[model samples]
Target: MRELPYDRLKAYEGQPVATAGAGKDLVNEPMIRHWCEAMGDANPAYRGPDAIAPPTMLQAWTMGGLSGHTDRSGAYDELFGLLDGAGYTSVVATDCEQEYPRPLRPGDRITFDAVIESVSERKTTKLGTGHFITTRMEVRADGEPAGTHRFRILKYAPAARMTKAPERTAAAGETEAAEETEAAERSKAPGQPEARRPRPVINRDNAGFWAGVETHRLLIQVCGGCGTPRFPWLPGCRGCGSPEWHTVEATGAGTVYSYVVMHHPPFPAFDPPYAVALIELAEGVRMVSNVIGVPYDKVRIGMPVQLEFLRVDGEWELPVFRAGGGVAG
Candidate 1:
């Protein structure tokens, strides 16, 4: 019997993918401050004297970045070459898991090593058929065990493009055919049902925001400490590191600060080529939402919009902005 492709991939497991690698820079407060600012993290533990790096930033210290690492072994390249030869060339990160044994602080020198942890059997997914490859890296800070990071990726051939069926036509003499064509047209009408949009993620931090949507109101979070308003509600204020906040109803006015048109790799609920805009509200806070009441191509930066509640399906309600002075929520 011929050996399967999965069997060949299994041979690469438990092999060293990289060894004796060292971080390009030491753990420093400057990089930590930049990361916290970008992530909107205002926790006091990450700032001031006696600060520590965020636990989730473990992998960041050991990355080779754009310069690429010279310590990487040929086994990693050979594994990818095999997959490419088998016509599975596309790749996407699935997820990652990490564990911290000790806190990483400033002035700590970092080093790491990685190995091929596993190769899974062939499986079919919405993206296509592919194998999952997992790698585990052990990280150390100043020669002490600091953390472990496990990353998984999928290498697959992309699925075929989706297409719609041809529209049916009626013939002059065929009465039954004409009736069937009419029914088909009715089924394709705009009033017919559609796949529901993905539901919003509601946690304690953002529950108030969704509750406001249910009540047909737009709410912005205002920090009690600094009086700064913020959107996409955070648990704490970024400006003054304050967790105290209150909600204020918006005036339903905004402008497009930035926008993008999505057109590739269509999903079940979203039609491609639609405009998603970064809207700056009248209250000086920004949020991302879809722009309606205009064609996708007509959406532009600096376009004025009014807030409204959009019911995409039977149960879910979302906040959207309408261009051209459309109806308010």
Candidate 2:
């Protein structure tokens, strides 16, 4: 394989990638509601007469959507062409950071400009060998600076795909010898445990949510001030900013609103090609969890699912959605 031209790639740093890019729509309530519904964020502050969009939704206002923006400069395209020519055809967003200087209210006209901030030297990662490209955008609301967004993505050739070894039938005599060897190995290393799944980080805001999972109950937070319910528990109502809240048990009924099948970069303690779904509960909030009792390919939008507790390992139990009563083969 030809080596990546790192010095040539880095030469595009500090160039203008996008300028005078205007949003397709002004900040509005409908988009805000959709984002909140998809994220299971029911902060009361996002609703009602005096409301502002979520701070995290800063980039949403600037997206060009399916048609893309005409204001994008050729420098960005040329940089990507250089990487693709070197066989780094695959790309994945690595991280993003946003800072809000003012709230984005409804009816605010959004515009932005971006610069190619930097490019990193080629590095090997678990996913593959890649270079990280960073971009910084200055967002404006009604021609005044509102926030800054910094995004980074890794462009790389995908790692070689892994294949399973073919199975071979063992002769009767060979099977006996293999059984004896396995018994001896087990005796030598008793109870070899598998790696644990990554644990959820519990903080004061969402600690109660995990505690409820421990007892096999799904809890949603209800705000005391506005009487609104939210999932993935928050400390205060996003709508009213009231800190007082109570818990409500979920009814365990929902439908698959959207889903994705994970099939790459398999991890220990997890089987690949499993379906992770965004479930829209009957209570009008959405949360992400795994879908079981059905093949990953069979899970579809609007599929009925019931909440169920799954004991992943001895130490962990999680809430997962089951497609039906019977398990899929």
Candidate 3:
């Protein structure tokens, strides 16, 4: 039997990645304020004199910024070196999972310990063949367990791009007719695989929002206790500690409160250089969605937009904003 090239990577499991690590900054108001501003999250819970950090900011406090942690062990680097030597030179962060046991407050100090949790067997993906490396970091605030962060990354060689078919020269009329026929036939062909955008994670908490999308309506969740509105559909209200909420259909009018242009690590389902906007609805709640009806460069803060549904593929529809005062659908 032939041995697998990645079989040796299994030995790296359960190794120490970092220990006795300390965060560069303590939990403070300035960082929390910056994060809130960037995310367009005006939740009052994150501001003021008694403010606590957002639960999702658990990993931010522990990050060493551009100058990485000095306490990181060499085992992690050695593992990467081995993979690089084997031709898997490219790296991409796949995803991260975080669990917060306690709310981090201002003046709380942060410390952490991390270990290489598990290494997956070599797997082939659209990006190429590579092994998944998972690291689990245990975070503490003021010497008490506060949270855990699990981060995963893929190191793989880039896949060769598909070659385009050569163009044929002929009379314009015949070429047009032939091309139209070919496209029609291709669309009707059986067992043809099509690239699709990744489906949004639809769980109980946000299922109603997706349901609204299917009907071409945008619904915002309103807290029954405080009359405050929220987007991205959470199960409970962040204010007043209320789990009771109701849905309200938005007026479909909004402004581009903020936006970012994506232009790297292309995905098959999305073109690069597209604008993703943070839209502040007329209801005064902000939601993130793609901006259409204008070039990526033309999207700007305070630009007025109208709501519409984007049919990305056969089975999925997404709520998007169309800029330049187009009628709302």
Candidate 4:
């Protein structure tokens, strides 16, 4: 299979996150109750037909919640620029810290702003790995300070290829296309907005998990509700009535139930002819993961899979399922 490409961690160093919009619409009562119940915080104050938004509900809002903005266009542009210069390598999110001042309600007008708090020196591990951390913060509901969060993102630079370029070049063209190959290997930092394409803000909830991937762990929600398992970490589970659930360790063993190879993925980090997979664990649960351990041309159906934590962006290590079963050949 095609190896995942390099990811950029400090893609937005020189620009703003541009969190503008009118906020998520919380219309249906059942939906509000659905969220509240998931948190196991079924307070009467949050119950009625026009119930309030639960405390933990705001974290996932960037995917689809409301305040006063509906876009992250400029933010994505900056990210691509950063990633390009940093090498098309793996990026991931590793940690997050949050503080909430006011509880989010159904009718609150929320606005958010994001900024990279800092970027640290890159470190190489004992395993011969290179990585760094970029921390960012997002705060909502300006006047009252609804919520504030800081995410420590992790990213890795792949092992540099020792392949050499062609012979020396002069204006007389003594080189054999080596300059072109050498230039291609170099990362490009974006100097202008038009230098790159835009994507969506991955949001804070799953953002942490994405970073966790680089740390080599499969972090999932151990539902506070039904003791069921959930991914894309949220405050509660949709299956049962518990809200106190937290994260637990996963062995990352599963079977491939479905898979798709993308010749055209919208994300720049992904290469063409790649496979996005649906893996069903022995526990009877399925997760959306990418299958490795085979060529994109060699990927097969029903392949046994295990989890792999790869550093995608910043400190976030992503847990993508690999096709092979163990650590050795």
Candidate 5:
């Protein structure tokens, strides 16, 4: 491995990266609707005559789109070039956090200024050895303070590929004995404990949804004011801005609205090449969950599926959709 220029990277920290970068479009209904649909956010406050953009969509309004931003400072580009020159050429977004002071409304022009928040020392991770670079942007709505978005990305050289060992053939008697042991394990008592998988981050807004999952029921939130049903429950209705809402049990019947086959960066808790789907339930709401009971390549949009409570581990149960009547082991 080549030595990374840690001092040069750390020196760029706290520098201004972009100034007065503007969003391509003013806050408008069309873009808001598209965002809400894609996110499956059905807050009444995001619709109707008086609607506010989803607070989590703070960074969306500041996106430069395909043509890129003209106001981006050379420092930002230089920082990336330095990393690339150091052989940390690949980049992947790790996560982002945002805080919104006020909701964005239609006709509000969006502008932002960003700074290189911090550059971490070179660290080793599952993806590879890399530096984590963070940027913080202050977003304004028509010159008024609206929100702040902090984004982080990992810049790293690709991990060395693992070489597979040659397979060894076993004798007939040894193979039979191995098969017998496997069968015995499978036929063991169902009460045996299993390894626990990662748990979901449950917060005040989505605790109820997880509680419902524990009981093997799929619940969708319904606004009391406009009677709009929504998935991935929100505190208020996006269509009517109603704070009061109740839950309705989903029929567990849905169709795949969109999907992606995950094949890279395998995790310990999950196998790669699995299908993750955005399912549109019969209740007119959509939610993201794994689509099991079929091969990853077979999961297509509009495929009919039924809800199944999947026991991911001994302690956690998640709601995953099973394609057709086939069940996942």
Candidate 6:
């Protein structure tokens, strides 16, 4: 990401950011329907009769819509406004990836809780200063999780978002006055350290998994009641709703289920043009990790992989997998 001046980063801090407001029944229906059609996903589940919402619809709808739980009037727009107030003028939606647990239909009231996943200042570029920001939003209906939204925003601008005077527009006020200071602080304060991002907090659901990682072994939860496996250390089989479960050592061998080649430097921690894969392990469990020791072109469906460990920011160890054929960088 190209960075903006500190003045730009300072522009919008302390502004009130909100994502509130009940919207009319998906005025974006046509756009979503068109997208599905263009993608050739003519399944009845998302067509005329079934006409169910496409799994990705949540991206376009709740992006700035009525779904996610925020105090802002528009989710996407509100996020931009808040960023602008902080002085990040060149705001771009770097990418958005989503996982669907269930389908969203018409007439469902959507709600979500968004968390700042991470933030980083980048090395200066010829274009300008850069900052990589990531946010994770979990959507729910009633209380059950419906999906997770991973959003990456890159800002490149000449001016910062927040400052002491905040664009001294003299009519007895400033941009700071037009916007609520409370909004900019919602995600981050201008120039604040990046540690504020919400991360995977350890608890009963996933304690053992991390323990095994500390011992250089990978563990997955096996539901004794329903015979299902899970990750992020869940309490029970998401399949049968059984809470009884045990741990199993991963054989560390698996095949790729789905993947993508990330070209953009959306997250500062991760390098560009890396292969990110969801591998199905020998235990019939799928885990998300970066494919190390292999070139992006060589990654394909059903490629073989083994387990490796990467030390992420937290004291906990992150489990990364390596494909069997090639050695990683």
Provide TM-scores for the models.
Answer: 0.72, 0.67, 0.79, 0.41, 0.72, 0.48
Rank the candidate models, highest lDDT first: 1, 2, 3, 5, 6, 4
Candidate 4 runs further than 4 Å off = 1-94, 125-138, 154-157, 161-238, 241-255, 260-276, 281-283, 287-329
Could you give the C-alpha RMSD of every candidate to the true structure, in order shown?
8.0, 8.0, 6.0, 13.9, 7.3, 16.2
Give the better candidate number (1 or 3) by TM-score: 3
Question: How high is the lDDT of residue 245 in model 3?
Answer: 94
**Taking the candidates one at a time, how many backbone clashes does each contain?**
0, 8, 0, 55, 8, 49
Per-residue lDDT tens digits for candidate 2, residues 42-112, read 67789899999999999999998999888999998999998888888889898899999999999999999
TM-score, cand. 5: 0.72
For candidate 6, give the lDDT: 0.59
Candidate lDDT (C-alpha), each: 0.80, 0.79, 0.79, 0.54, 0.77, 0.59
What residue runs in model 1 are displaced by over 4 Å at the alpha carbon? Answer: 1-4, 164-252, 263-271, 282-285, 309-315, 325-329
Q: Model 5, clash count?
A: 8
Which ten contiguous residues of candidate 5 have the minimum total lDDT?
180-189
Q: Is 2 or 3 the stronger prediction by TM-score? A: 3
Q: 1 or 4: which has the higher TM-score?
A: 1
Winner on lDDT (5 vs 6): 5
Model 6 residue runs over 4 Å out of place are 1-86, 90-200, 311-316, 325-329
The digit string of per-residue lDDT tens for model 4 on 127-175 reads 1143444434454653456877677655555433233334332332123
Residue 245 displacement in candidate 4 (angstroms) = 9.8
Candidate with the larger lDDT of 3 and 5:
3
lDDT of 6 by residue, 1-329 (tens): 23345454343333333333333344245765787676544445554544667777665555553454446534345545655665556656667889999777655666666655555555343223556667676776445567788888676554222232222222221223113222212233357432221245578767777779888898888878767777657665545557788888877888788899988543333334568898888787677877655556678888777787755443546677766633211
Better candidate by TM-score, 1 or 2: 1
TM-score, model 2 to reference = 0.67
Off by over 4 Å in 3: 1-4, 36-53, 101-103, 162-193, 326-329
**lDDT of the structure predicted as candidate 2:** 0.79
What is the per-residue lDDT of model 5 for residues 232-271, given as tens digits with 9 covering 90 to 100? Answer: 7889876777899999998898889899988886443444
Encode model 1's per-residue lDDT on 1-329: one tens digit a residue.
12236778999999998887899999999999999988777667788789999888899999889998999999989998888878788888988999999999999999999999999998777666888999999999999999999999998776543443354443323333234223222323244444335567789999999999999999999999999898889888867878999999998888898999999756445556668898888888889998776667888888888887766554756787777542222
Pairs of residues at least 3 apart in sequence or in different chains that clash in candidate 2: 43-238, 43-239, 44-238, 44-239, 44-240, 45-238, 45-239, 45-240
